[model samples]
Target: TKQLNFLLPDSDATVAFGKRLAPALKQGAVIYLYGDLGAGKTTFSRGVVQGLGHNGNVKSPTYTLVESYQFSEQSVFHFDLYRLADPEELEFMGVRDYFADNNVSLIEWPQRGEGFLPEADLTVSLAYEGEARQLTMTAKNVRGIAILAALKS
Candidate 1:
């Protein structure tokens, strides 16, 4: 699988990178966001949702757990499992239903749902590199490979 790694100097740059990556997000794609506190995961997601034709706001689902944005042709599900107490809560909430063929899921803190979460097509890890952010993306499946390829260019 192909891997793409780079640096974004600020939140604007991070969002710009996410915007560039948005087009490769096909239906049923599961993207995992890995980052610590204060990282730019939510900012990146906002760029993606906006790029996907959502004219409204994109907020973090930290307290709400999940947030959905509906578009004419597709739906985007942004999940923040940061506060999840147990992974089984995902099953209890019927998370599998969210993975439908026409839906796109961008998951933050996916580690919190570990065993209950579906396999991720792409994994994005963000870390601090001095004053900037270092981003590394790995492809876990064919769809992710295509997405990573898009980032490579």
Candidate 2:
């Protein structure tokens, strides 16, 4: 329920934050990414995947809407809803299935799929502050708060 704010000096700092967060993640966790266009959502997701032991390229699922990765220990789903015409489209895409007990989901523009997506454990909001970024991590559940604590430590 507490919000933690971190001043990221650059895009690299944001990526580093994501890298620090990835190893602490567990299955069934949901991360909501909120920001305007070109806010480094995809860049952060790349760091997350790399930190999770993934050695492949990470790209935004803008047109496709969702990108899935199957790891040795867990699965990660990246969702970009900017192209979504309606929230109901999530139902047709079986969005609920991605939030099951075995997966961790990172969603961008979550407002597009409000009711269809599961509640986020963590919400990371990125804003451009001059040339740098200000990142605010808000915990919506116990798991998220734990992760934030770990990041702080």
Off by over 4 Å in 1: none
Q: What is the C-alpha lDDT profile of model 2 across 87-121, one tens digit per residue?
A: 99999988777787857899999999988988889
Give lDDT tens digits, candidate 1, residues 85-134. Answer: 99899999888888888678999999999999889998889999877999
CA deviation > 4 Å runs, candidate 2: none
TM-score of every model versus the real structure? 0.93, 0.94
Alpha carbon lDDT at 49, candidate 2: 79
Q: Pick the candidate with the highest lDDT.
A: 1
